[model samples]
Target: MKKTKLLLISLLLTDFVMLLQPENAWAGDVQITCDLRVLELTSQQRNQIRLRRQQYKTRQRQMNENLMNQNVTDRQLSLRHFFSKSAFDNQQADEIAKQRYANDVRQTVAELNFYHDIFQLLDNRQREIWLQQCVQPAGRI
Candidate 1:
């Protein structure tokens, strides 16, 4: 008898909970899913992409070398501290560093553009996968 009563109560509770949920609760959700698979590429096409990737890698190495090659020419401390003195003599050094920085920036932009161009070759599903992994996008389409 006790078990029968417990079963009856459990059935009633489930019925009451089901009644509390309104209709159309699951209709508002949107899901877009796609498979990501690399398609076949000809040998020539593959070689072209490999060449571009190598070029970007070389530019990255050069930028890193520029930063590593900077010489810290300041040693003595005087009344002419970090900002008080005119940077007249060391102008060449400053210019070199500035040019290196500009080169680095240009190379970075070029690398990103290369990647963007390559991404355009992806299929819709592959593009979605690429976008999901990207943090800062190259820019909007």
Candidate 2:
């Protein structure tokens, strides 16, 4: 009985660890598809682009964490005011919303720069291939 219980616990822990793995852990398909559609490049160019993509992803994750932290702080502040029975001002709320929107725009611009850098790294023919395979579908190329 003891051995069975221990085995079950071990299995549960393994399952939990697998569940906690990051979403991008399995990106083989995406890379393969990109390689097939994009123009031929030197292995070094491919590796460099892969490294840049990873860096961009890391920066994006950090940005998301910062945004979440900011949201939590704002929510806590609102809760504190509510507990104090403070009156909510519509104007103040509107200003906060505007500020958040402006921040979102700035973040979007930064993300665009990362994408533009990736596009710039691609040769003209590769860029065209990328557009046809990915971006042009959405008329976003």
The best candidate in terms of TM-score: 2
lDDT of 1 by residue, 1-141 (tens): 999999999999998886644331221111112222233445655676678778878878887786667554442232236346566447655754576467645665665677766666666765666667543322221
lDDT of 2 by residue, 5-119 (tens): 9999999999888665533232211221344334787687678778887988888788778777676677678657655656877776776568667755666666667667777
Which residue runs of candidate 2 sit more than 4 Å off their true CA positions?
Answer: 1-36, 71-91, 137-141
Using alpha carbons, what is the TM-score of model 2? 0.52
RMSD in Å for candidate 1, one decimal?
Answer: 20.4
